[model samples]
Target: MRKNPERRASLLDAAIEVLAREGMRGLTFRAVDTEAGVPGGTASNYFANRDALLTQIGHRFYERLEPNAALIAQAQEGPRDRAKVVALMHELVERVSSFRSGYLALIELRLEATRRPELRRLLTERIRADVDANIDFHLASGLPGDRTTVVQLVLSLNWLILERLTLPDVFPEEQVHDLVTDLVERALP
Candidate 1:
């Protein structure tokens, strides 16, 4: 397989767009090549197979969604209180929702995972690690929450993002902010 990091990243990004726009059923090497604006067989050179592409996409989703260094620094500056946690939750929602296509593709991949056991295992492991990291971070940061609080916020906020993406009318922007505040306030000590 080709080992060009930049090319591989581009192909994976194109795959994400294809998955979001076309869903799992429409995702293919040809579709990714077209999305990436590369010539035929380009994506095939980078990925071994559909499962490999899907697994890479699962990893890439988290890579794209991770907070930047500046945001982490800013978060660390503030007092670790319930209000800070609320701000963090708000930031989290905004950050994840900002990458609209990535999150949408993740949803599609999740549904597809139900049929593919390998994909199911990959997503489960990655998501579990992410959840664990969040719990550990919350505990170490002295954030006004326990493991349950972090879990609740993660679960609730993910659905909130889904709602915001799939059904924008259900909760307007301002209402979502208010809801985040309410969720954090109620979840924390």
Candidate 2:
């Protein structure tokens, strides 16, 4: 039978919150129950096991990126101008900076995915699709090439930005903005 969407969604939301606060070990059923304000068995009823619950968390992690995908695709199709492409990348970079929890969840997923092939495959596919989408967008925008390397470059830049945020020093947002802007001209242009 289909699980109640509200309950399922609530549990997923709670899982992310718990994951950020406590890492994967923090996702005890009791913690999720309290976080969701649901009955003790509510999450278990849907997931039936810990792996199921964790997989759902990974799915939620990817879902948060979906809206931005369309915006990027639109930017790709709408303009060949370098300024527009760079602007879209700026918005994307800014969004990533603001949405720290999702990034943390992704870091956790990477650590956990080694033992969970399903998650590894799911994340792999999601990344491939994102890269494909971005490439298509760039192609439509009149980028004659840059098929394989853009994904690697974009993700590398993302990791660099995240790492910078973890530094003891001030975030240096302007530096990152300038850096990403330069990357846009070099990579997406």
Candidate 3:
């Protein structure tokens, strides 16, 4: 009911922390309030319900996770060969690795969405747009993959690599790099 942007952002950040640490089952407004060190009911004041909080969390996740302008510019300047694509993949994996908790929270939100049709539809549209953007980026950068192949590679390999890197010692960095390289090479023209 109140219009406090900073407070809202803090609540969302706390929600992400709660989601990452306690999973969706633990993502109550009270949990977020505790995580944010705010008084009880603080999160609920900002978000009307769990669905609203989860939706905002999903939106904020993408806002925080999308590649920045500088990164995009750097990618644009680089050679658009297989090596560059592999390098980009490495960058992506490294970014996810660095933000492991945030990404894990995202994964939890995704899983939670499956049970809610409205949430599922919203997230599906957002993910599709993200994939479309990736496909366009690849084409603009002169990478050698058709839209279908790029879509598949992005959705499948990104999930696999993210899941692998999130868990303990599932795969080494070199192995991930090699795997991404192989995938990119296969997808390339």
Instruction: Give me the candidate number with maximum TM-score.
Output: 1
TM-score result, candidate 3: 0.90
For model 2, the superposed segments whose C-alpha errors exceed 4 Å read 68-78, 141-145, 168-171
- After best superposition, candidate 2 residue 66: deviation in angstroms? 1.3
Q: Write down the TM-score of every candidate.
A: 0.97, 0.83, 0.90
- Top model number, lDDT: 1
Candidate 2 vs. true structure, TM-score? 0.83
lDDT per prediction?
Answer: 0.93, 0.73, 0.81
Give the Å error, residue 92, model 3. 1.0
Candidate 3 lDDT tens digits, 1-189:
667999998889888988998998888889999989999988888888888888888888878778989999889885677777778887886776677767888889788888998788878988888888888898878776679877767776777657575764676665776777777777774
Model 2, C-alpha of 78: deviation from truth (Å)? 5.4
Which ranges in model 3 have alpha carbons more than 4 Å from their true place?
Answer: none
Worst 10 residues of 1 by lDDT: 71-80
**Residue 87 local lDDT, model 2:** 76
Superposition-based RMSD of candidate 1 using all C-alpha atoms, in angstroms: 0.9
lDDT of 1 at 15: 96
Q: Give the TM-score of candidate 1.
A: 0.97
Instruction: Provide the lDDT at 171 for model 3.
Output: 67
Q: For model 2, name the residue pairs that clash.
A: none
